[model samples]
Target: MTSKLTTGRAGIRRGAAAIATAGLAAASLVAVVPTPPASAGVGKAGASPQVPQSPPLPQSTQYSADGWKARPEQYDGMDIERDVPITMKDGVKLLADIQRPTRHGKVVPGRFPVLVQQTPYIKTVLSLPPINWALVKRGYVIVTVDVRGTGGSGGKWPVWGEPEHSDGKSVVEWAASHNRPWSDGRVGLFGISYGGINQLFTASQRPKGLKAIAPAVPMGDLYRDLVGKGGRGYLELAPAYLAAVSGLGILPNTNLLKDPATALKNIQEHWDAAAGNLKMIPEMIQGGDRAYDSAWYRERSPLTYVDRIQVPTLLMGGEFDAFQRGTPMLYQRLSAKGTPVQFINGPWSHAIAAIPAAGVSLPGVINEPPGVKLGELQLRWFDHYVRGVPDPALDRRNKQVTYFENGANQWRTARQWPPADVRYQKAYLSGQASKGRPGALGTPVSGTPDTVKWNLFSGLCSRSTFQWLLFGGEFGNGPQKIPCMTDNRYNDQSGLTYDLPVRGRPLRFTGPVNAHFTVSTKSRDSQLTVRLEDVGPDGSAIQLTAGWLSLSMRELERGRSVVRNGMVVQPWHPYTKASQKPMPKNKPVTVDVEIFPASWSVQPGHHLRLAVQTGDFPHLFPPFPQLKDSFGGDVKLWHDKTHPSWITLPTQPS
Candidate 1:
């Protein structure tokens, strides 16, 4: 009945050149490997009495443009070395590369408690050497560094995580006062994405001896991890991850590339001048007005330091993560401020949680089968929080919450985190015709339903004719039936479906998902989205979490709403502003739509779906085809029984 959609300067320059050639070929394959030294070890711990597993594969060895080195007969008991600098205290030296274990005969170090990471990708080649040789052959000392401006560090890069939280608290106070030889001043931090957002901005600056931190898919909130959800900017991950970290800050390394075909033509002309200066990121965040301005893009956000985090945190994420709502909003703001948090999620993406899960390998690194070992659960969480190891199985109050359900890949723990007993159900949307025909199916209601109609189209075409055939192109199609929710052939009754049906046992849902309903439009302001499916058994619906609003920024912020089991938690609503008046086309108004946190179970005859459309092609970036004031006319959809559409399940705990 009314519509508009934009975005197509040749599909935003071919999605910004396929995200800048897959982020400069993954940061030039993590900068040609070689960093390594600082104490490279492996033999000695118990001198060889035992512990010698990992090594059924991973030994391909092949690094030449001048690095990859390490061949002292391939170590035999393992102990390699390379460059290891660490000057800091404001003089800025950085560059680290340690790996431990050797202490002669039985490698028994005096003090041992360090696990830092600090990355700009390329700590001697996309590190993670079989989880740093299984945490230095099970002794732990690790290191890594190279932040402040990327490898061979110095300064000037500062791309994300609030200037790497004071350079990751000055590389954990210079790895706890260079006490070297595995000396302890206590430290722990791991990495994954931007070294897990510099371990949550150096554990939110609680630095000192640091204590513990894991970070995994962490990015926590640089405007919802690189501008997205609503503040929109994720045009395929910000100009291809800022032209692959500004083409790894102007290529070079291999000890400063001396020739090799003129250093691969000056690293492809500094990756085409950092992908042509990614259209001056909104004028460099409006001339860095400060707040750490890159154009005041919300002052390089981190959700403004979620209450300045306290330590003992873990926070991992993935629901095909692209920073899945900043890792559950840093585990719901560090477990609502009590700290000592945990929270994990799976069914990963974002480089499949740093490789390995297909068969699972670690004998040196390349058997590549295991996808989520997360470096052996971040070395048993930095060996029970930086080596005070009593190992009560990593007790951060036991089960803080964990998830994974790509058709049950297993691993599901929960003492809290969208698991209370789940039972919030609502499915309503009778049919009868109003704007574009076909309705009269009536009677099969449970909650909200009284109106539903849709039909919008304009510029940039394909506003999802079933997500352009279930996620466009290639052969990566697996979870189907989610294009227009059945009845095939792009059925569009302004699409609205809600199912529940189950029977007994097996029905666990997890956090964040909202929808409210009651809309009306013909054009003035429009955009609803809301997905949340599951379906299966033969009908195939999949797609578990999705949300987007824009009906003149919907409103709903006050105490942020809450209802639990019957669904409705609406908190996290940073729409910011936009609604001075624009909803006349037909006018109805109700808007809620949150949808993003997830953790499923379903089972027992399975069904739990919910879909409401307005458009979401290419994973968003459509609305704005001159509707001028955010279009929204003649587009009604309401749930019945006096508007009672619901869905809020985090239940689990017998």
Candidate 2:
């Protein structure tokens, strides 16, 4: 069964509003404190796109962050200082909006710690800045800068290049310096998506007075996390993301009428920058350094510089986020270095995490333990780190990590991620499976290999659509509201599945997953996706984690690939042009697919299934050359004695 979405006025509006849209991240729109909201001036260009408002949370769902509560709002409102210019080292003046606590029409006396957010999206049109005025009212000065080449800021956008990194550090220093009278000389960085990702780059620079950082739903490895889903460009979402930021960057600056010359220059620079980025998409479609994990990708990936970030960090990720594969990687590196860090992995997607549902619940999908409001959690992080205020609750929080384990349906905290007791286990796929029916997992039988067709539209209404679309792609049809996106049954029916029945206690698995397969295809090339899902007795398939691999780029970075007790738990592929090679048609080749990490407890009656399919474009997001190269073919998965296939899973001893 193929997936389809009914597009209409309501659906289209919902889709557009839900995109990260550069300016849409950062504001916590939860049940806010009862006060006249601190108002900030909207940019002459326009206000940020508004999302549908979620209703108030039920009292039972309200969460307290380990007994941590927000500091009292000492001010009635906040006053905005718009179009404030901050000159960078290269003489480019980036425009910023400063929001300071105010009463009546006067600025409050004395200084407050500065909180900085650098956005590629226009700073002035940022969505609902006033909604965050409550944060300013709590004794903090908030500043949001339009990253170079966007908004009123000068200089060309290098697309997350050295210039942006340098600018990030320069901006942090500017906010933390005494040059700004309102600044208390201490700084913390926060934002979502673009705003959030830059914090890592800036903090890695180790600017003075930088205290802490909390990057919500940010990506560490750009190429692997956002650009390249497996070994190809993630066109399913990357194109839209690139187009949005670039297109919005070149828009006319409404606040620049007073300075026509500067405004024209800004537009010209942005147009050129956006053009240069868009040009690379075509190059990427054809195989080149742009398509591979070359220096271009490595230089911009925040993970490359994570070792240098010394500040206390709070990283938030969704189990279903685009960056799910890399958030834990960053967390692990930070923890290994003994850097103060906390990680929260929710069952949310990027959009849900950015503008959460009322009470942390996503309607009928899953209800989260409404923990401390998201904004409050960020406040706590900033207060403890930037403000230097001692909080016993924070000390307790610093020692633990939080995660929402689905299926178990509760907030679970551990001293470390994946819990130390988790052991790597393997479930082998059986060779004896009938045509058009699912096969059994474990205790392999010597029989014929299974086959699957190369079908690009296989993953349409699955979790991948919801995940890749960055919103609720699960809502099928206009007003008909079929819950097909969340259910993997539609996808599984079209793929090859191997299941392992669960008995006695619930078969729980937590942490990274891998699918090691030995296969051959009718064509010289093929791209395949592996999905680890929970199959209920009612025949419902809930995708837990997924991985992708193109046969051409199957060479592993031996040293980087993770192995435990001789089993490859996490396989790392370089995805470089040099590593990419055409496959030998109809020849058996082994592949190790790196599935994203997740913590889920499959209830007793629910069996675990590993699924594989190819031509899933909406999720695979492969570039044109790769997609075209592996366009159509019949692929075979061998599970006979000599060519056994299996999945490596992290499970705890019962």
Candidate 3:
């Protein structure tokens, strides 16, 4: 088998001066070598060069035969390594490539703590080598271990964080005990996405010598973040994640099944089967026993242990990432419980973490934060916490809850999340042709419309259905909108729009979102969809967050539901079996739609837009395919001084 490194649009190249300085500093690190043979010849549109296959090294070897070594040419005077395997207690051997200064035979005066990252993404010889080398030169040991069942490890793959955390904990302990030159008892964990979540899981367990963790773009809840809520799933995220993981699971030298050919075939077969039966993958992968049968899923979930986390943690996520809701929940819980947590978020996707976002480009790769610099941040974090370095950069005062404003490229930080002193404002949705203006009043009422009716047949199509056709079928073929809105053409009022003008200085909303109104359906049961957006000066609407609720399951648990800002706030609650009670048709009832929590700043000129439709395409799977009693034939929203319809927001006071 042959492998090559492609310096695509994403790879970073250092200047001569930087390389020379790195070389001198990394002299005591691991001996440097040329770019790993795996990264050589793999370029944009270029075929990978063939290389001889060598026998697997024995477990007794301190590092894999292809382990971390210096590569002078790859990075001027930098040391590099690749495919170093480490064995864990459960006989699950994992691979990690190390990069550090070549030990100059003299006892290094002080032992440096290790910066560890465990991810499912393959750390190719070229991709992460510079990062490791940079850390080594900076007097730190950098270890990049592939998570269990992904790269050179034994075990069946469970999507997301579960098994990875266990593997990470084991690796941290092993690195501490190993007799390597820089192997001190202290360890710091860092990474993005699955890599990020693992840090949280590992830290929550409060590992013996674990000092600190930096989990960027970290996922918070599994079921809510991954599956769906209010009986709907974020269609695109689940399938895309499964596809990506399937690819990662088939990487060379990672599977115990040995031959990449056979492994790829097996993975493809499983993936194909999964595609055919989407609902069964979770249960099938989990196997027979319900309790702990899916230990991986249970272990990967941070919600299972949020109150237990004690270490100071730095959590980051993207404003639009699938797991955005989870980050705040995790941060709030840990911080309020006095866990010393800091949160940072940006407008980045998962892939951008390892490639630089500005200026430099790797031929075919998306610009992500370069692995080398991310490693440096990890080093600084470790230096301050593990080594007690007293670096001003790692001081608590310098770190806070920072986020990116959609239109603003600059970053903003606040002492606390959901900033304090935000005013809760109300806006009424009335039916009228106002010509794009607010307060175009129709008759306002204190309760829902007396004879509000909607056609049940109209709610058949949804965002999930359209997405299924787009990505799974033909619509995904050509150039499409990058952040496309899910299609909802079949539902009533599909093009419905609502606008609320800003009343004061740029309004910053941070916290749970709510839409409150009295609703009545022509049928016994119905569904309602609500969306929140920020409308730009040019009339372009950017979706901030959304929510949905099935009236049938509107039974709220005691103490979990609160009425605020004219809307009902439903805290996180597990779904319970549906009740057998029946309701009279055409009766008016109060319903609260709770959207996901988000942080967004509505500029002075921009308007807060709320679009109310009976359906949200692709955002969720339609409650029932049969369309039996699902739509409320006619619906009326009442808003006025007495029954003022409004959206509640967590406002931070300036």
Candidate 4:
């Protein structure tokens, strides 16, 4: 905290400084205490080591706690150094909390590899996941730095902008320098969500001394993966994001005056400034603007500059993670360029990405099953790169993709994404959902056409009971919001359901799902939503993945699309304003929608269902207010030979 650093925002009050210091040390739920583990000494070199049990964590924040505690901290003799100041190249000073191995209330004498995590979330509060203790005990120095504008740092918080990136490089270089205690000048990056995204962009700069990064459930593109999807903004989620960041008060004007009483006057000033910035966030994200691929959005997206990353990386997440789309694309781009990288997708959600393989549930509210833990794998990765410990298993695992297949509830390794053995199959759509018989999915049986209609007022938001993972807890207790796996019969009644008859044998599916349709509507523009569901024998429906496309943004760049095994894996679409076209009355138009990727197993006798609807409400604002009521009475769909409408599944052999 002593380093002389410039305050980039407004001047800070020195006495007001004590406010942040007190906040960091207060007994609020967010306070982080780096409690040492059971004193278990290490065995001989290469000897079987005893697993260090994680210290008891607060139950309220168990998700974040368990996330940190999921992995055993092998090293028990560790100590924390709080509020260390780090100077950025621009002369702005950031704050960091370091955890290092210690003995007899003193630092252990040794140069160890460093792992840096830059977070807007308070570094001292959220830094020590249970895994960091284990890492420190195993001879690593873990530095959790508060990004500019947040924590107790001296600067205007710029969020994920250039200031944060520049500060990140400076922090890494400083940690790698010889002056820091216990650091060997080698650094690796790690974090989840916001923490994870910072790592990706920071590593893209390829700062001196940065050796590797392991980002879990990171948003590859801010516009596409974070604020919106398929060119549409997440109306409800965007405001929620703003509220959470504002609640943190992480970015206050830090320009401090020397006098204590004078400094207190600036507290209100800081509050006002923070509030103003929060107000601007919605506009900054273009939350209400119906524009895609804008220069403002592109500048905030890592997708545009990801090619600059040169460090080895481990992209990790759950199959159902909110940030799922971006990671796979990043993995593919990096792998194709021969940058050392690996991807691990599991059956968990964004909150529990780091939960241990043996899941723990707390009472009736929190029900969790065994999940993939990255602690051990991370240790191995850093050990090899930072400590010179060669691991053949890491090498082999990286040669292909490693993911946990849901339904099967087991981990599977594949040579390529979608797996090399995947067989993409198409199921044609037919019949009427409103009819008692509903619709059937099968081979073209007579090439007959069918139609179903829903008024804009009739559509219900099909969010299911699943709480968004990002909104859930951070570490240990895991997300209190488990995806609602309950029967969706009631929900299916709200949309058009096309069910496949009972399967003769178990059908396992992996990777992305595609839905192609030929439809016509009287409205000038509309939104067509498609959802994948698993129908059990009892008639209960398990919702799977869903896809959405604003009718106007349906123009696809087919030639630029990615095709695998003659099937479109990722269809490139020009969602820009220029490519937008209106739908003419009764004029059939072909459209392709890419559903979210998934790994699910349909048991024998169970069925698969494709639910199509005009729109989903609340979750997304129904088109623009001006176009909300433009359903134009009725919508029509065709399945004749001339217009074969079908849903494609990426299937794996039984």
Q: Quote the positional error of residue 75 for candidate 2 in Å.
A: 0.3
Candidate 1 has its poorest 10 consecutive residues by lDDT at 69-78
TM-score of each: 0.35, 0.88, 0.70, 0.80
Model with the higher lDDT, candidate 1 or 4: 4
Q: Which order, best to worst by TM-score?
A: 2, 4, 3, 1
lDDT of 4: 0.60
lDDT of 3 by residue, 130-245 (tens): 44444454555566666656544445555544555566666676556424434555677765566667677777666666777777656666655655455444444455555555
Tens-place lDDT per residue, model 2, 343-442, is 8888877656664311121244433446546546777787788877677767766636678878888777777766787899878888545345788887
Q: Report RMSD (Å) for each prediction in the order shown.
A: 21.3, 8.7, 11.2, 9.7
Off by over 4 Å in 3: 1-83, 102-111, 123-127, 130-133, 160-163, 254-299, 351-379, 406-411, 431-495, 503-505, 522-526, 558-570, 578-584, 623-644, 652-654
Positional deviation of residue 305's Cα in model 2 after best superposition, in angstroms: 0.2
List per-prediction Cα lDDT, in the order shown: 0.51, 0.71, 0.50, 0.60
Q: Residue-wise lDDT of candidate 4 within 151-194, one digit each (tens)?
A: 55556655467776666666676766655535566788876667
Q: What is the lDDT of candidate 1?
A: 0.51
Clash count, candidate 3: 57
CA shift of 384, model 3, Å: 1.3
The clash numbers for all candidates, in the given order, read 46, 4, 57, 24
Task: State, as a TM-score between 0 and 1, how close model 1 is to the true structure.
Answer: 0.35
